[model samples]
Target chain A: MYDALKNITFIIFDLDGVFYRENQSLEGTKEIIDYLNEENIEYCFFTNNSNYKIHRYKEKLLTCGIEVSEKNIFTTTKLIEHYLFENNLDNIYVLGSKQLQDTLYDKYTQNSINPNIVILGMENNITLKDISNTINLIDKDTQIIAANPDKLIPVKDGFELECGVLIDIIEEYTKKMVQVIGKPSPYGFDTILSKFDKQKSETLMIGDTFETDILGAKNANIYAGWINSGNKLPYNTLDFDFMSFKSLIELKEKIKEAKR
Target chain B: MYDALKNITFIIFDLDGVFYRENQSLEGTKEIIDYLNEENIEYCFFTNNSNYKIHRYKEKLLTCGIEVSEKNIFTTTKLIEHYLFENNLDNIYVLGSKQLQDTLYDKYTQNSINPNIVILGMENNITLKDISNTINLIDKDTQIIAANPDKLIPVKDGFELECGVLIDIIEEYTKKMVQVIGKPSPYGFDTILSKFDKQKSETLMIGDTFETDILGAKNANIYAGWINSGNKLPYNTLDFDFMSFKSLIELKEKIKEAKR
Candidate 1:
């Protein structure tokens, strides 16, 4: 059914829940790497997780036995840095991680009493004061820019809240919409396309989650292949048009057959 | 023009900004007290400031030389207490002052990680952690109850952000509507009416701000006389219908002339 895989020039891969869960890589990831190499299909990694830098992601990918260059990786943290740079925003108040904060430390304003922007990212240990300061800053005309809009994220024990939920709550309180710069926002895909010099028609986005990966691809006007990995189709799958496969192994076999 | 004041058997006076600014009482406050006494009209002091309890408000009024009994004082803090008591909500996460928290300490839950309800009120030194906790708590289905929805308050320095602004931000973050208990909410007026057993037509709400006092009166279906005090009418005045007078002294004169 995926005869279009032969025509696909570049592929965009989502990191978490696709290539790896947390500490371990998923089952069919190595197969995908081998198949893509055999087909000479170029691929890049994209993640909305702003907690880690590109080098850390590369190290993690290396441990998973899937070797990739640092330049081939894209994260929301990098996207945010680009966004801030583009908008000429110097003074920023961040509700994010130590890594994300350190990445943009020069632009970080310790005081939220007044700021040019308030960047919202994932913070597992987010406190009430962080939210209060952000609200107050927004009230003072400081804009909010979220790293991504994923509501719930799978943790070791259970699912924890994400940036989208935080953004939802903040937007509800302040009556201000936060600017998002991750998957499903099309910004990440746009960045990837621009960097790789690929056309939307020739590029394909592949991942497990339909909300981010598939929707992001659709939003960017690119083809998407939902890697179900032999799992039941998610509810959002019906709403969007996309090719579905049981596993990356099954997808690769189809790609090989399409080439014949 | 306020012949309605002659028919007003009960009067609700806003304390700060109307009768007084911060430290000193305004010019017309004493005259209103005298007029109410001479006419045998029941009058009470109503304020949204939850910084102090009833006794402190009484003491403050005494210092201003406008002596009134404790029974004649009504505050948003008291209204919130009544609301919590009525709702039987004991497990509360409070964002309020030390005095206000102590006022309802028996009901206040020391932490918000898990609470039946989150109560938002006045906190001059509110932090981001307070807001983050509130947002997280709300995500757990904890209900939100607010003292008042006043966005800005006149302080010794200038207009400072109020509990309403915090509530707005919280509401944005949580997507939960707060149940307000103070001016413009109608809950306070309902409590006042039920306590005094006066019909809306026979009661008058007098104050300087149209957003709170007059709007509350309008919401409660009660008559309202805005005390302009020879000052320019506020922006919200055009949106609401209410009697206007230069001062409470001028309103009193109109009341006397209406009787004659």
Candidate 2:
């Protein structure tokens, strides 16, 4: 374990595909948790899903047999909230669920007349009227914000459209691009780095997706470990220097061998 | 009028921007109707909007001060119905209004499992659940048909998301391209040409947009007269030969000159 992780002082992990999939923890996750605890290495889980708060995620991780502090988890929801607060973007039209809307309730507005921004997030109840109203509000001055850049999220039977898909729809209709504040945007990474005081060279990003995890790590100037679990490869990762493995155990072994 | 339309025995006029805007008739539309009638010219109104049937469009046109037969109108809805009927594609899942759904009610399926085709059309009350269900039904074998390749429809104040926009969202989520059956596709043009036995050289396609009108005309190998009424150019027309005019009056004069 030391041989594999010797060069990395800090690690950024993706929650959905890396640690667990569909609420079930992966096999090598326990070993990695033990190893990380033994090595006293700094790590954090960076998830693009804005569906839940960080505390909820902390509780969820606890149930999955992974003990992590609330501060160790950085969510896109939190990142977006921070951005909105910092930028003084008080008036917002959220096209997401009540839970997601509550994340920025202080700044959210029903004032369509002069909205500061329009935030796109996951909403099972989102309607054409919601989309049309959002379309009408979009102009040169209106800032369109997308929570994440993921096109789809795998479901029980198939895939479900995510925030990025919604953003693309709005962009196509209005011809105005959306500002994604999640993975691959460098904003989330920058926030994590700044908050944790971590150096780019000393940190590594681990996840299963190439577009969000690997591409995001590249954008943030960090090493990436792609957990390719025979899932579909959506994006081209040929240009990046990323290590790919079927399991976290294999990746750990490779890292161990390299350090040795 | 005879000199301009001497060679053109038939004309296909687009309804939305060419003849009317927001339920109001445009200038020179009445004169064109009279001129076409005086010359005993064969003409039809080709519209991409599928909200109303041919008879309803005729009534709407009459109310707008243009008298035309129901047979002299073509819509994307009609084009889709014809395509579905011809191809024997009976099983369908529609993400559109009850009226549009009723157009093919005999074949419409509410079965979430193994649908033959998913037809995307205009729906004001479309929900995310509808989008999700459609996403789940999408596979390699499933045929995704879009009514038109339009991103937005011009509403009273602003624009609303169109069928093509819904198609785009589904395409992005499913990673499967949608087969557009309207406008720039040439399928509609080919059908009209074959059924009506019209010569491409003798027929003119006149509209106010480049994407559908000019592009579709180019694809169908017909002359296009763009009624560019100060709307921002959304597509490139550099590769195609199309007449551009601020008003249909100007286009009429140009067509008259060419015929002379």
Candidate 3:
């Protein structure tokens, strides 16, 4: 059962709940990173959140006492840039955060009239009017893409509506399909694997979210380890065989035990 | 074939697109009204729009050269008031226009925390934050009701999203069924029929929209007449029998011919 962890040389970690929730670092953040560094095991952070840039995540990680290069982090914004470039998509309209808008608009032309692609990301202040305007801009030919398919993201107070809600509204109204760039889509997972020059079998994705982290690992054909960070597994697991740990400390102990 | 119009002593008219588009009166509005008046047939206006008060609708109809009492105009706001009163419900939360808020809040207690019902209506400036806040206020026991299920309303420029979109988002996110108060639900039609004290067989529903006007008539077990008004009939009609009129003048002529 634990033998699968022994062959895992490269690891992909989901940020938010796994490493740090909001600005506060969770348990075993520094310990697991230290253990991975000592073992020469490669690991990188992958977040479905497109709200902030890579520097913000890097700064946040530093606050958690885990120093990592910006190259080791992969946000959906980065994955979207790669996706657009690879697919030769331009003339964009983004219904997302300022950071996402600034990043994508800098690389591509902002066409509100008729864009080649319409990118949707999580925005705190998104309005129905904005969504309506986005729908108006979208014609039959315009491509729709989203950062992630997480309907609601757990916040300090309660669950806040995520990018997936926007996707639902847009897709239902426009009757168009929205391509998700983040987890469970294999685009982000494949992109991360290719960047690290690692094979799927050699990589293990550890995250709190089962739908994205575990299901995404399965989708990308990578080994999965679910870190129980106060999130319940959905009723139907679809019979996925993934290692589960109570905490990152437990995960670190399991990896050490496997190696020994 | 034309004998159906002969039995229609009481007529239910859908205001927008049928009688008028915005402030401009469409062709045959006054003609149909005059014909109904000459024949001593009872008629009233029923609109899914909850934005305006009854007075505003009366004024709009007056501008269109069709003067009917405010009592004869049934907006969703008025119908919702009736619904809440009839169902013995209070402590309402409304995500609608200013008029709707004023109307409902005037009658029912404005409860943000643990309300008995959450009412959804079309609001032009509704934001995602408003929707998110509305979702937060809703508990498992809270009853969700929408003013209408019209997905889009034809505007001067293009189609504006209606209450149906709000229902779509709320229902999808909350996994709650929203009870619709307006057309195609039979609540509005039933209320109107009862108020007018007329049987469904002796009534006719004339409107431009097939889904709301035509399907609503079918749902209410009344005669339906679809006035072209530039709206295409849906692909699948479920084999419903209904009359079609190019304009109100044509409808008026058919009734006259049926009488002759």
Best by TM-score: 3
**What docking class should model 3 receive?**
medium
Task: Provide the lDDT at A172 for model 2.
Answer: 72
Order the candidates by lDDT, highest first. Answer: 3, 2, 1
Per-residue lDDT of B215 in model 2: 89
TM-score, every prediction:
0.80, 0.86, 0.96
Model 3 C-alpha lDDT per residue in residues B36-107, reported as the tens digit of each score = 899999999999888877898888988888888999999998999999999999999999999999988987
Model 3 alpha-carbon drift over 4 Å, by segment: none
- The number of residue pairs in model 1 that clash at the backbone is 24
Question: Per-residue lDDT of A1-260 in model 1, one digit per residue for the tens?
Answer: 37777788798988776777768777777888887988788899999899988999998887677899888999999888888887788778888888888888765445556778888988766654455556666764778899999876654534466787668767866788888899899888998899899999889898888788888888899999988753346654556678877766777777778778
Least accurate stretch of 10 residues (summed lDDT) in model 3 chain A?
A152-161
The Cα local distance difference test for each model comes to 0.79, 0.79, 0.90
TM-score of chain B of each: 0.91, 0.90, 0.96
Q: What are the runs in model 1 whose C-alpha is more than 4 Å off?
A: A22-24, A85-98, A107-144, A150-178, A228-239, B22-24, B87-89, B93-100, B107-118, B122-144, B150-178, B229-240
Q: For residues B1-260, write the lDDT of model 1, one tens digit per residue.
A: 36776688898988876777667778767777877798899988888878887998888777666889888899888888888888877777788888778888765555546778777887756655455545666655678888888875544433455787668667765777888888899999999888888899899899887888888998999998888754456654656668887777787888788777
Tens digits of per-residue lDDT for model 3, A12-96: 9999898888777999889999999999999999999898889999999998899999999999999999999999998999999
Q: Rank the candidates by DockQ, best first.
A: 2, 3, 1
- How high is the DockQ of candidate 3? 0.57
Of the two candidates 2 and 3, the one with more favorable TM-score, higher being better, is: 3
For this target, which candidate reaches the highest DockQ against the unseen true structure?
Answer: 2
